[model samples]
Target: MKAMIFAAGLGTRLKPLTDTMPKALIRVGGKPLLQHVIEKLKGSGFDEIIINIHHFADQIIDFVESNDYFDIRIEFSDERDRLLDTGGGVKKASWFFDDHKPFLIHNVDILSNIDLRSLYKIHELNNSEATLVVSDRPTSRYLLFDDSLQLKGWLNKTNGETKSHFPDINPDNYNKLAFSGIHILNTSILSYMQHFPDKFSIIDFYLSICSKVRVAGYTPVNLKMIDVGKPGSPEEAESLLL
Candidate 1:
């Protein structure tokens, strides 16, 4: 039904490109990164979309208007005055997802081949509060899950640290899944986040209460994906998708 593109980041990693433009405006495969994400969502049958804007916010707004919103319903959640982190950005745009159905949250710079319709279906079938796209990809940090793939803990490989709600949990026994920066969240999750601060990471918030709630991961294999997070990422994404 509806989706929100997380495009408000400063995108410092993209360096010179982001100096004059937001990362969402960076081109990959001859189109802006934001446009790619929007087209993917539209192709997946999600016509109503919301994008948050912060870095060079006006430029993003102007570009969206220029495209006539790519012939779909598009709205902007303004964060020009303050840049809220992932969880806070979603919280700020909670009103847009008032239809009581599950909504998607996708990063602007991520390119993936995951089926959005099927992912949503899985989320519905599981009756979950949220379903994060997890993979066996390597990363500095990972979300840990139990045998049933239930959200259990978090681990930071760089520092050899771990956090688990289960007192008797063993890090050696849990599975590590790299988060794909894509998620489907039920509206009920908003109520659970009422007590959180306005600028916290969604991952942190999830780990804080995963013990009491349902935050499952969807680990699909043979999935082609890429994160256009750095200056040289566009070249790589072109080879993957174009």
Candidate 2:
């Protein structure tokens, strides 16, 4: 199956280093984060992959060209003109997938031991429109799910803002799970998005349709996942990822 890596972000959080290079090219355990993600996807049976580029686009392009895409079919969704956020990035690359197949979307900054094969199986088994990889981790933002693991709404812990797809129920009644930058989306989800211009996060799109769409959460908290977005976690990341 095909997978898309969201690597176009400027990564403001990882400043200094990101000032000159993209976050995907940042060194972690002696390898670029983008390289590690591609290796992981390759291990999980994803051959044809698409990567979005915006910040330091030429550097990434050169790096990939030099390595020959690690013997995998790699394609670029060039966004040097405008860096579309997650939702728009995926929409731009929608033409890469074929009918009767699902695609994987992952973040470049996130390193996870998530089982993509199992995630694809769960998504297919439940016939869900999209399966989001989530965990019961502490975070300011969370996606609320019902007892059946169906997406209910979203909660912002810091601001006390709550958005529910089901207007009748209180958000506090559902389970709040943090999103792990991983998603197994059916290509059909693209049909639902109308004309969203510029940049927009994909989570907003999910929240808009949680009431009617079958968006389920796959809990794999036991999996070792880390967001290497800052310099503080380098020691920890080196131990876990290397």
Candidate 3:
């Protein structure tokens, strides 16, 4: 299986620590966040992996080289000249998924115990264009889904902002789930990005076509995750590791 890791973010939320290092290099439980995600993916049967790098791109490249690419088919999608957001990054790396199979995408700063293999299996079984890992965790922004877990819309609770294709969509009628920054997408879904710019958010892309395609959500049981992109999250992630 193949997977792509989103390690190119500016990681502004981590401030001081990220000022000199890429967020992917931030150590949690004595391992770089990138290493954690890589090992997890490898354990889940992923053999080929590509990581996108922007902030301190050289440092990430050096780290991977030092580790001998973790003894797998590891490649780098360099974004040193221009950082592409999630959607654009994936589009740029679309060539890597030439096998025409569904591939998984993961965020470097997210620490989670969700079973990746199971998540991939679910995506294949559903034959969905994309399958996002989500949770009922409270958050300011959420992806709204129907009872069948098909994505319907997105909501920003702080500003009462909602984005949906349905003319009369009611937020109160759908289940609100927090996205986990992990998802699987079919290669066919890339064709839909032809109209998108070089820098776009994956969520926005999903919400724009979700009503027309099967963009499903998978909520894992006992899902424990931490967005290690904030100020004290590294410490918090250590406990998660324990």
Candidate 4:
């Protein structure tokens, strides 16, 4: 199967490190962050991968070419002219994925131990348009799902703001699952994203279309995930992720 790594971000959170180099190039356990993600995907039988580049775009390109893609077929969805955010970045590279199969997306900074094979299997079994890895963890924002694991709303904990597709009635039995920055999406999702221009978040795109499509969440409760966006997070990731 094919996958795309969202490595184009300027990575404002990583500060000095990202100011000089792209976040994907940041090292963890003696290897670049992008390398780790690619290795993980390759282990799951996803040998063909595409990475979007923007911040220190040339450096990322050079590094990937130097390593010979670590034995996996790697392609770059170049965003040198304009750094398209998650939604636009994926939309730009839609042609790389064959319409017959689903594609995986992972952020360069999110290191996780979730079983990709299991997640892929569940997505295929459900015949879902998209399946996101979510956890019952604390976060500033969360994707709300009903008892059936159907995405129902989005909540911003900082401001206590909530937006639900079922606005008329309050959802009484929903769970808040923090998105783990990993997702498996079928090609059909591209058709729904046709209207989004230049730069936009995939999260907002999902919320906009949740009422019409089959967007579900896969909760691997026991899996360990680390959003190594902050300086402190890298410490948390040190022991959990290799």
CA shift of 126, model 4, Å = 1.4
Q: Please, what is the TM-score per model?
A: 0.97, 0.95, 0.98, 0.95
> How does model 4 fare in lDDT?
0.87
Candidate 3: lDDT of 165? 93
Give the higher-lDDT candidate: 1 or 4: 1
Pick out the ten consecutive residues of candidate 4 with the lowest summed lDDT. 164-173
**How do the candidates rank by lDDT, highest first?**
3, 1, 2, 4
Show where candidate 2 strays beyond 4 Å.
none
TM-score of 2: 0.95
- Report the Cα lDDT for residue 105, model 4: 95
Overall lDDT per candidate, in order of appearance? 0.91, 0.87, 0.94, 0.87
Off by over 4 Å in 1: none
The stretch of ten residues in a row with the least summed lDDT in candidate 2 is 228-237
Compose the digit string of candidate 3's lDDT tens values, residues 89-175: 999998899899999999999999999999999899997999999999889999999999999999999998999997778899999
Q: Best candidate, TM-score-wise?
A: 3
- Cα RMSD (Å) per model? 1.1, 1.4, 0.7, 1.5
Order of models, best TM-score first: 3, 1, 2, 4
lDDT: which is higher, 2 or 3?
3
